[model samples]
Target: MSNWNGNWESFARDAELAAKERLNEVDRISESNQWKVIKAFQKHRVSDFHFNSSTGYGYNDRGREVLDEVYAEVFGAESAIVRPHFVSGTHTIGIALFGVLRPGDEIVFVTGKPYDTLHKVLGHPGDGTGSLADWGVGFTFVPLLGNGQVDWEGVKAAVTPRTKVFAIQRSRGYDWRPSFTIQDIEEMVGKLRSIKDDAVIFADNCYGEFTEEREPTEIGVDLIAGSLIKNPGGGIAASGGYIAGRRDLVELAAYRLTAPGIGGEVGAMLGTTRSIYQGLYLAPLLVGQAVKGSVFAASAFERLGFETHPTWNDPRTDLIQAIRFRSAEHLITFVQAVQRAAAVDSHVVPEPWDMPGYENPVIMAAGTFIQGGSLELSADAPIREPYIAFMQGGLTYAHVKLAVRQVIEDMHSRNLL
Candidate 1:
């Protein structure tokens, strides 16, 4: 609760009170909708791929249908498609770009520096296998400013008659910093529309979903893309990607979706109906709880002299939080402790190895029961300096407290404490 930038104790008190106030506001705002949907959500069985649904179904395009309802609730935008086949966030983006642009058209990446994988996708390796550059489509970047936000003037400079799309990525990373605010998106859209009404305005809606009450879909973005496996997957969705956008673009995406696995253009539902649905249902309350856990972890770590990224005093935050240790061994140790913190009756050790397509190695303490990232199960990934000592998943505050304690205990056991 304390704000290290100023008076600490007073800030802590005020921050706590404000947080409680916000919680009250959220409850009041979501009262009817939250109760009806989330309570019922508890009734839905946890979805499983091995036993319950199609073995290789595409992410539920039907999921897109649900996003459609969200769109109507938010923007007046026309259609949506959610597919489980987008193996990673990268694939989902590829599908959206391929679906929207003509072979000879162009797209401008509005993000200053997007996800690491995206640089390649935007034609970085002009001749590499499956590189998007082979398509003859042109791409450009809207350089970001020092604070890690889009440079509006640079964007205008990047625009061209050939530019068929403008896209922004929102997700977890250490490359610049957080840039896309609700206001930034709105302003970007205004600029795009003024430049060219037909130029598609797209956003990579990843870990950022449920971060705020109002989403880009609600703010008039032409298309919003994201991964279910990360957020709405709710530790349930086996795998999937979703695109909610202009009706025609969505329809075209369905066609490209054919090669992936959704049954040739009608779209792959990826048997995610129950899981994605369930994840979405539990997301709001779960996300709120995650922010709380993050606040605790961030504050505690910051107080211990490690650099941290979040504060309980801030408005609301996404589930992810980072604590930089500045050393690979320390990073691994931190991840191990965090995982131990989550296990109630058992412990799991994390392994660090080189990830495919990753120039640098990535480490993860994956203790998931379902063979995927499970918030319900505790885990952490520390990639070295700026290592994020991150953790999420505790059904209640008590559960999170236990996890936090155990993690700290592990650190003490090793004398890292």
Candidate 2:
């Protein structure tokens, strides 16, 4: 705690103490996750030579091929397409969704609305931008029950003969509901299979990787996609995303990513192979650190009389920590203060307005090495009712601790805490 104690305002001293006590449980989970990563590394026989880069047509790119093999093995999938070309998690999911569904195919989201960026990909309300709907693919979602559980009856009524894809978002995205866990995803898979035997079950796995010991691919999901800059990036990968699952599905996604026949074979890794491999190697540890920070944030904010999701000791499914504020002013201030705590762009203040893909005006404190890296320390929220601030990512537990303390001190100085 020395890093925080030396300069943190005295107002946060009690919060720091309480946060430290709560860290014991976090440490237990992190330690277990650490061993899991080591076992995966050992099982795959990862070596320094595998970090070598490939160029040109990338023919016989053993390093690239082996990296995919390792990712597939670790994710418990038959195949994987991990590349820097897929710009974002949304892009990766788009490839998987578009690859599997035909023009007349219907896509059903059993997990309610997806992340905001996906709304554009799905062609919501038809923006005429070559979205899924524009391509003649149909979409519908079964809203979650009040308890955040899937409305099975509604899902049953929603599925049609043309329903070819059952999409599940493993993370909560901007939603207030709890993110789906591995067990929950497993149950959903069973239920979906019982209804539509051939439906391609896809999981948007962003921010949800390496948190649980087993992945969605390990359970029963047919395909899983995510951004490399999030959980699996290990705070080191500067760009890219990954999709891993059944070989046939991954092959289809690979075709969507590159071309009709090239698939995952021809893309040049450039100079990113080493970093991507290293990032995946370190992902479990980084995710654990982020989860710890989330726990600390939740615990500290709850002590300050704010409502927090998945209260401190609760099992974490993703890295996000949400604190519901009383008013929009409090939410904006909280986001601004979080930006101030950032090591990068601390001087810049964020304002809530219409961000590109969101419905509500969103404020974001994105101070990170990678432009939009959510696996680093950052906070953001939509300016709306409930006024919840969602904070996530910390490359290290200490940084997350410092950031959470800064938020408390900032609120206290304003007489809001």
Write down the lDDT of every candidate, Cα atoms only: 0.60, 0.86
Clashing pairs in 2: none
Q: Each model's RMSD to truth, in Å?
A: 5.7, 3.1
Which candidate has the highest TM-score of all? 2
> How many backbone overlaps does candidate 1 show?
11
Global lDDT of model 2: 0.86
- Candidate 1 regions exceeding 4 Å error are 1-76, 125-128, 259-272, 342-346, 374-400, 413-417
lDDT of 1 by residue, 1-417 (tens): 213333434534443454565545434533443454454334432223322343344344333444445433433346666666677777887888888887678788878656666666666434755556667788887777777666878888888878888887754454425435566677778877887788888888766655565667667788877776665566667787677777777777767767444323344454556666666666656555555665655555555467765444444434556566656666787666656655443566667778765556666555554444534535455365555555544434445545555555555566564
